[model samples]
Target: MTDKPSGKSFDKLTRRQTLAAMLAAGMVGTGMRSASAADFAAFNPGYAKNIVMPAFAQLAAASESLATAASAGCADPKAPDLITLQQAYHIAADAWADAQMFRLGPLADGQRAERFAYWPERRNIIDKQLSALLADDDTISLDAAKLGGSSVAVQGIPALERLLYRDEPLPPTGCAVIQAIAGNLVAIATEAQKAWQQAAAKPAPFAANPTEATTQFYTNLLTLLQIVADQKIGAPLGGDVAAAKPKSAEQWRSGRSLRNIRRNLAAAQNALFGKGGFAALLTPEQSALADNLKKAFADAIAAAEKAGDDLPADVSDESRRHLATELLVKVNHLRDLLRQDVPPVIGITLGFNELDGDGS
Candidate 1:
């Protein structure tokens, strides 16, 4: 469910609008000046090079490996080959989770976000689509490009997870679909990596507009935090443990739900406040806000890791649910710091409404 679409809103100003409004509020700390355009530009290249490009490159490489392994498994369909393919899927899944933070640039174009990793699936659509494809063997041509253009439910990671992890044995059609979807992932990741590479090589418009990039970075961080709190943990947790939906957890089929959140927080930390990051432009008060946010993210990740790998199971346990709730609190606190404190120090303004669309 990485960067999965959501209907939630920040209920304040979007991060970009907040940044602008912060400038007029005169809220910047004493002896601190607003970031100059030069400040924005100075940090942009490093952020692109050190954070954004590497994420896509890793995704591209991991996806290529997944495609190769799936092709071999499809060719052989033996127990050993399937095991190898499963391992490859885990590696690629983790890579995809890490890169979920940078769901901008080519990744957002043409609904590629939905196409790459469609999730929070409605009505068990992946199951329905995969079942139908397997049932009608002759109807499945097994072309990567064509399949990618088909129902998005069957075109990405969630679909592949269903095929690989289902209770029943994999049909020959399932194997074919696995290979095809893996190939599609490879193609998409390669294209995205190349796009980032080109942008990094040149100063794209995003590079020139540091404020916009910073705003996007903040929005992305806040969105990830919000989703972690609301959708991933809260939605499934519901009003209480009795209302919990274990199946609602992200990566439930693969059982990496908590791992996904940990990776997301790590990426958010690096993207916003890491060395040579957007945080470098912050005033002293803003620096304090960033530092507090860094701690909060670290604390949440630590709690998540300590809660162990079975997030769905953990959610059902009373004590574990308490820990999960604490993690949610920490994330919300971090989001508030971004919304209220950091923006003003960085000379970003606040707005009365949240961002529309997926913050990613």
Candidate 2:
């Protein structure tokens, strides 16, 4: 790595500060909104469905809504007014930031694997994509300029005013999205850690993995899947149709702009389960995970088509409940398979104590 600036004065800024600078300078990001519990439906295999998917659903709505509103106003997807777009971006960024902090731990002491790795590895993808959304005006539209100075608009939430991210007229809404996305990653890690704590009394077996990296990967992957599957809100079980297909003008406009998101989802999937030509990027056990997840994704889609989204607007609670139940069960089956694999892969094959000192 280019030798980091070494002079004491130059080095004083914390990693978060350094990260902020990178964020402003247009770093990249992982595709997709944030990593969540729903992500586990693929990793764990059978905890529950619809858990982590809700947040993603909310984010998807926010993204599509932003696009729809912009389209209605005759603004190109590329021309989203910074102020309005800023809201979506920051929410995304905040979510991302939360995840980063959670996985890496506190900003108090700079930690790379724990703190900054994901930014370089994932969030940067978002920055690069969102930054391209504007033109050379380089200055906010006159109306938006006025909006930025007004205290009432933000409800006086103190502007970040930090060096990397500024208040109003954002260069890349994706960077803001990064912050939001980070939050989710952290949440996923927190839940995994929590599950681990409870495993001992129940003879969970994950604590005995062969390697820290292996164990961690499995822990992070499975626990996240369980939580999201059970929740079933955003990115709802049996609901990837919205993402896989685009409907609105914005979707058509930014049709392929989301390639990174798709790519990362593939990467994350490979890291957890291993398929879609993602095998080379994972371990042997992870490859099996990819196979298991592939089965789950296929099963969820099958269940959805059978259940049908055509339920009457006023469909009875009983019918809707059944549909939801069947959908979640499909998702749960996937989670169960993955979860069953975690203990054996980690404890018997990898060994838990091995991880304590191995991870960077």
Candidate 3:
């Protein structure tokens, strides 16, 4: 007689069967007619007031603290000061990771997001620009205003990371560069926060049409998932065990690439399921899909956390690489659910080629 299926295999078959049944029951494309205009009205403003605004405010606060820590570390350069500065950097970076998801309104205006943290910097541009600036150390060029107008690569987190994460103590001029970059981060964060506050009052595009505004938020959510899977993890993981390129991982110098992914997934969960979030529009009939989406996010986040802090190392070591690989798979599954299940239920139609471009 043929052997019975193993427990894991049986579970997998059961899940596939359940999904197929749900799809056949019109769970995928049947838009929820019960979702009211009032639900849409509450979604945008509530997301802004509760989720987006608070994140930016935290970012502003963290940036200010980072600037202060940078100044203290520059003056003292003591071990304690350096530790404090690094801790501040971690907090500020985490805040930015959380706030970066909104990607709408003020954050999109004036190249603000790029100015704050330029990534996928495949050319080693930050180091090149920073090396040139440090070599010259021309007082005018080092000024925050001048640097702000310079190449975006040198103006943000990547540049600051290079300055702080070196073996040798920063030269006096290097300290000055750190201070300038910290000041620039503060300015960029504050400008974004102030603009968001103003926009919250009017909430122009968000308030204009609920469906369009929600589509924007949905697009941001899916795009971030793709970036995490493709660039953040996949780039370092490469094609196979022999092909791994650990240095390509984001924030590898400070070893927070996986931490960034965890935070991004957490923020995405909040954006979708928190009070007054997109989940508010879900009808009773759509509860199963909502639960599935939530579970997908949770699974992805758990995998990221399990992968640990040293993403570069995780991707490089053949034995440890599966953790990163598993995280990538979970992220892709989450992205697929959002793309296939969410748009139909929410009444937004995304083109097949909608998310193909460079969203960043």
Candidate 4:
């Protein structure tokens, strides 16, 4: 899914368009500012040092690569499979780029440290990059295995594919998955914003470098998480799989459906955690995300049975499109709570953000 076409558009981006995108969004110099004080200060920094920044940077750089890759093949497709690969490449790269571009100033360098305008430019880059990456896919090989080994192995044909009709385009299951992550991101960000609001109620001095550092970190995390949420889920949820034009709506749907599970898996995201957390078979992949997700599928299924709904349909039905959109928002909330919960850099900067705790 990562190979790219080296075309005029892609070449143009490297030469002129990239600068244009950076400039148009004022990311080259002006525009975009940092977030407020409370946002970064709340998280543990010691753990975050090796956690957030580098990952954020890597995601940024990788996304850049992905965008370029996608630009090369965003448009044409000779086979149904190739279309799927193209879309997946575009979606994955799109997600990564979007996540890294959150509070882009941390990524950008300038006199005033602007982020707003920079991110908008970053947005344009994502769109253009997707287009450019897909401009000519003739060079791309749609050799089934190359597109990830029977993207529909047992495969392709399933309920998940239902969401990907011409009207739906992106497929229901995948869209649901995308929606779930995005919604959580927005919700989490809103929570951070609320925390910021509360900070206003108890406004503390952030003039101290430690406090400034804490504030900046918190804001960046909030912004970054939101970006991750939106890119991985929201954009894809609203995308047109038909643009890639998979062989059949069914094929498109199934691929997208499976992607719902894959995106979270790839991002090291989980869909089950907390109370009633199940003891289920852990695929080698699920091990990483298990702690972060709510094990609510069984519960939803049981509830669905009691309510006289079909099990799969019942479980897949979402009160909200975030995880529950893909899988229960409330349960998702529980999982989110469990998130302060996990990750490699979870406790790096212990108590660095305390009012008198001196971040260093």
Q: On residues 81-106, what C-alpha lDDT tens digit does candidate 1 reach at each position?
A: 66777899888888888887675467
RMSD of each: 5.0, 17.6, 11.8, 17.6
Clashes of 2: 81
Return the number of clashes found in candidate 3: 0
How close to the true structure is residue 249 of candidate 4, measured as C-alpha lDDT?
16
Candidate 2 residue runs with Cα over 4 Å from true position: 1-83, 90-210, 233-268, 273-293, 301-316, 342-360
Candidates in order, TM-scores: namely: 0.85, 0.33, 0.85, 0.30
Candidate No. with top TM-score: 3
Model 2 poorest 10 in a row by lDDT: 152-161
Location of the lowest summed lDDT over 10 successive residues in candidate 4: 111-120
Give lDDT tens digits, candidate 3, residues 1-360. 211113343345345433432332212234445444455555777777887889999999999999999878777533436677788888989998998887766666655676788787745767877787777747423667777777777778877888778887665568767778789889999998887787664423432455556556666677688778888999899988789998888888898898899999999999888876778777778999988998998899889889989988888888998899899999999989988877767766543222254332
Clashing pairs in 1: 12-353, 13-351, 18-348, 18-349, 19-348, 19-349, 20-349, 21-349, 22-348, 22-349
Q: Tens digits of per-residue lDDT for model 4 on 1-360?
A: 222223343344334423322222211112312322343233323313323333444443443343343334333222123344345444433343323322322222210111111121222232343233234353133221232121111111121122123342442123322222222222323332333333332222121322333333333333333432333233333333322211211123233322332333323221122121111222445455554443433433332223231222222334322332333333244334433433212211212111122111
lDDT of 2: 0.33
Q: What local lDDT does model 3 show for residue 128?
A: 78
TM-score of 2: 0.33
Query: Residue 9's C-alpha lDDT in candidate 3?
Result: 37
Error of 1 at 14 (Å): 15
- Give the residue spans of candidate 1 off by over 4 A: 1-33, 78-80, 201-208, 284-287, 350-360
For residues 97-197, could you state the per-residue lDDT of candidate 2 as single tens digits?
A: 22321121121222322221222112233223234322324323323223223222111111121212344443444233323323323433344444433
